[model samples]
Target: MRRPRPIAPAAGQESVWDYPRPPRVEPVTERVTIRLGGDLIADTRRAVRVLETSHPPVYYLPIADFVRGALVEADGASFCEFKGAARYFDVRNGGTVRRGAAWNYPNPTPGFEALTDRIAVYAASMDECTVGDEIATPQPGGFYGGWVTSSVVGPFKGDPGSLGW
Candidate 1:
């Protein structure tokens, strides 16, 4: 399939098209925050991001940053060709519950070991997810967990008819 030309990135912006195909992992120092059901569920400055072509960065936070008792294991699993199998978690705070709102790779594929036990939440499923000063917009489609910020540009994948790209 012929991929569409990437949108030109303005200064200070990164085009998702520029990301690699196999994905790359890198540490991020920006503060990441996740709030669900009107409660702060996770916050951390120590995070990592997975960057892949046509997708926004997915931020993974250390398990220690989550509010105690907020993440309850849920009954579901998903597989990633690059990251290995992932387990789901329901985020509960106060009386609010978001079913299967987060996930973690317990045994990530080699080279992705940094992700093991680090949880990444679905930005769309949370009340708010932010990186630094920008609030995130969740990547389109429910299957992927990428958080779009102002610094990223895209003709991103996951929209209707985007599968062939």
Candidate 2:
């Protein structure tokens, strides 16, 4: 005879039980400095807080924080379901440096409106940047900046799941 699979003792049983749920999530904001050409390009005095489930806190800085004259508008734009629309910029340092390497949200969704007028530049475009005392490195790839350490999360720009740089 063939053996049948055994069922659990509590099959179809329903009962009220007390259990602790996960903690509520909140955004974390911090001040930072982006350095380029031996000068501080951006000083993030006030920026939006970011808290993804698997990622660390990222502060979204405003474009105005950067020296506007230092950045030239690039010929590119992207749409995001969450943040709304984004425009790109080329880091102008002597020559037409990195192209479309940085981006920002001119107008963002109400939930993310705090990022509006904020520019998140390509970390690679600059010589260096710093969050407090810790120096920030270029995020990787030809463009894009998730703004975290490579060891934590890495080389995500040119992945198959992502579009062209």
Among these predicted structures, which one has the highest lDDT? 1
Instruction: List, residue by residue over 1-165, the lDDT tens digit for candidate 2.
Output: 222222222533211111112211233344677776777677866765444422223456767777767678889899876678889887765544667767777887667766776667666667776665667665344444545542234223333443532
Candidate lDDT values, in order: 0.91, 0.56
* Worst 10-residue lDDT window, candidate 2: 14-23
Pull out the clashing pairs in model 2.
62-118, 62-119, 63-119
Residue range with the least summed lDDT across 10 consecutive positions in model 1: 154-163
List model 1 lDDT by residue over 1-165, tens digit each: 777777899999999999997999999988999998787888999999999999999999999999999899999999999999999999889988889989999999998999987999889889999999789999998888999998999888887778888
The global Cα lDDT (0 to 1) of model 1 is: 0.91
TM-score of each: 0.96, 0.64
Which runs of model 2 end up more than 4 angstroms from their true locations? Answer: 1-29, 54-58, 94-96, 140-144, 149-165
What's model 1's lDDT at 43? 92
